[model samples]
Target: MSKHLLCLALCFFSLKTQAQQSDFSNINFTKADAIANKYKGATLESLPILSYNLTSTLKTDVEKFRAIYRWVCANIENDYYAYLKNKKTRNKLKKDSLKLATWNAYFTQKTFKRLLKEQKTVCTGYAYLIKELANLAEIKCEILDGYGRTADVNIEELSIPNHSWNAVQLNNKWYLCDATWSSGIYDLNHYSFKYDYNDGYFLTDPNLFVKNHYPVNTKWLLTDTIIPITSFLNGPIVYPTTFKQAIVPTQPVTLHLEVKQNQEVIFLLKEGNPMDTSNITIEMTSGTYKTSVKPTINKNSDELLEVKHTFDKRGFYDFHIKLKEEYLITYTVKVEKK
Candidate 1:
């Protein structure tokens, strides 16, 4: 059998997921990598039929969804380096909005074609192509414009909205997926797209998704309470799959974080298995003062730890959660004087 068939075979029939929230944790990364390898440089028109066939073998919604999700991640080049490829045509307009809108309009149409021709695209193209191609397999999806967090930092005040991702309906609920992030990440130190498989993005829960993605329209959140953009920016920056189980940040965000400096900001964590008063310590290193503290933990209950701190200056702070004498996640916190 061809690698494509073998990948589709293994990926399609084997995935068993729970209904509470769709889990992409145990996704067939090998299959995803194989499929990506096959279509790596193939343009949109080059691989539509191939993409459809890969999904046609799968009968369930989740199966079809994963097939498409994996395929996109596999093949789509994030074009993080696209900026280096100077466009043949340049729009020298006085208004930045018009220029952005013009380019956005150009790329928004026939996205698959552009992806094929260029062999790369940004997050918008990734989202558009997913929705477009997934339609062939009869899956419902929507592209969402949003503000996204990057590399342990959340800047709520980006002058222009800088990111795009997707939401798909699964079992009557909307689940978030970021194909671009799945494709790869921009290496900040190197200034390049380091191509890799990042399956953490698929079918993420709304609460966690909200931390990185604050949709322009609140209606797309699909959560009980819509989080204001301000709160999303101020919340703790969580690394992939770390401390999510043992730590719950309160919202408006789950983390009880007030990002302003000179205020007593509270961090609340509800201890889970192996997370207890004895084994856990919340450690802090503040950037402004170039000093560190092991904050006093106030136990509100057996499961709850309310960590409090006040920043004297405006700068970045790093908070590391140590459980059982090992570091959990050193969550990034930014303190600004309001």
Candidate 2:
């Protein structure tokens, strides 16, 4: 498969979600959230009624959409086993287009059954349900298939599309969101679903959204920045908290890096808010042995933070940054003796 080119139409949707600027601040979601909480355990028998119950009393398009989005995130569970199976099959059949297409077609049916009956699904099911509910409410929403980059995704092995999200048109403007990421996280240690609602994925900023999500269709890219597939793949692995905290990694554009002993590597970020530098910590792991470091954090300004860490030893290491004990982003580095 050829590399998917990305041309984000940044100019067209700048005001919609530029950097840290959000148009949703003034819009109160109390009513919509309350409604979602009230209807916490809704079934999927009738989408129209679900949509109506979620939106009829809501005042605005965004609020209406929020109610539906929140309800789905809270009620539905991410099928981790199914997700693993789909990923394995997709990777195995990636080289054969015919077989891959056939498998996708067959699995889609099973996915729907699991979603409707058990309230469990993967990314595709989440996107489908969102689109169906939005369509029932006469809201403009679409399912977008593309690559979703997490720490586990090997860029070299990315062939078939591995994820799906949603694009919404509200008030004559386009917005992007991923209910799958927002719903919760899969506990890797225990191998179970953890219900942690992250609202950052709701109508996310295109600039930050492009960090991990690349839609198959260029038109869905609301930002105008031209990001190549290589850059998208090489970028650092960002977690949901990265978006929630409005922290964008500006330096070390690539995740993998090489440096000599005693060489210094700089980490830069554009913060959405003035964060306490003391709350940040960098942990480096080389194989089973792990160690933590307190890098010198300097504020370029209220919104720009810089971190400097020098490699004193030679090894292949994985670096993780945490803010207030929440994971923000990760990078891999190789240090060699001079």
Candidate 3:
């Protein structure tokens, strides 16, 4: 082989190797395994069972909501002995039994297994376990790294670095709930088993949370409204649908789709007919245009085709495309009022 050709081949191989190495750094499966391992050998406790009457009354939404509530209630206990046991092992201990800071630290590092085996953890550990359980139940929850203020002292401002809690979204609203404060010692024996589902903690006014807990994502503290996942998915795509928009007099709107590769796509329209037999027009953007034309409008039963050139002149217009038989995808674009 020529000397120049050998250099070119070596360069190509180096580039290939670099690309492969970069892909591995993007994933962190090891961290997840480490977390799981920390809780190994922990005894599995039977979760609290919902009341028979409550179970019968639960509908789809109610059932999902109740499942999460019951899981938290069943797994955590309010035993003072458990707290004392955990306090001895963990460091940076707080002398005050009611200190929220102590609770957060214990929960964050400990696992459910630790809680079951040792019967105690700090506040952070409790919050972490709660977050994990909420995730398992398919609920969206996040831990807020912030300080808490009690009536007695402004420990947070004193740089005491106290407290941790969770903000959960339910029915499109963010609610604050502090299981630690609620479950902490109460009566003489510190054996009070009553679980308080305090509304004071739920859908808390932002002003209140800001005074005590400065969340990492301040947006979570701004409103009770739970941001929908669809809002994020509705943003721009690499290959968005192209269409003509107008406003004066109602007229039929046409969308032109361009497919660069040979792939099957579920063609959809937000405001145009996907199944109009007589009024719709379909044409290939590329390739042998005539051969690529679809005969009769193919529409899925779940999809409907309707026209609204006048009503909705603003907002996004989305369409689906299936590329080759393997890839199903969609693209979207915005239309301004004319």
> Which stretches of candidate 2 lie above 4 Å from their native place?
1-21, 188-191
Residue pairs with backbone atoms closer than 3 Å in model 1 (clashes): 36-74, 43-116, 44-116, 249-254, 249-255, 250-253, 250-254, 250-255, 251-254
Q: Per-prediction count of colliding residue pairs? A: 9, 6, 28
1-338: candidate 3 lDDT, tens digit per residue: 99999988764443222111112234433433333333333333532222222223334322443334334433455545555564443334554645556565545445455665654544565566556665555567777765554433342123244456776655434456555654433466655555543323333344333434444454554533432323222222211111111001111122222332322334333332122244333222222322122323343464433221221233443443322221122233344444
Ranking the candidates on TM-score from highest down gives 2, 1, 3
**Cα lDDT of model 1 by residue, 234-272, tens digit:** 665655433234244552243334377677766675443
lDDT of 2 by residue, 1-338 (tens): 33332223443553244422267778999999999999989899888888999999988889999999999999999999999999899889988889999999999999999999989999999999999999888898999999888777745345568889998877767789999999999999998999999887888877678788887876676776666778778888898889888778878888888999999988998786456879899998987979887889887765468888999989999989888778898898999998
Off by over 4 Å in 1: 1-43, 83-96, 106-114, 151-158, 188-192, 241-248, 251-266, 269-283, 287-317, 322-338
Give Cα distance to truth, residue 217, candidate 3, Å.
4.3
In candidate 3, which residue ranges exceed 4 Å CA deviation?
A: 1-63, 78-112, 118-120, 171-173, 188-197, 223-338
lDDT of 1 at 129: 79
Error in Å for residue 173 of model 2: 1.8
Candidate number with the higher lDDT (1 or 2) = 2
> Largest TM-score belongs to which candidate?
2
RMSD of each: 9.7, 5.1, 21.6
How well does each candidate superpose onto the true structure, as a TM-score?
0.66, 0.89, 0.38
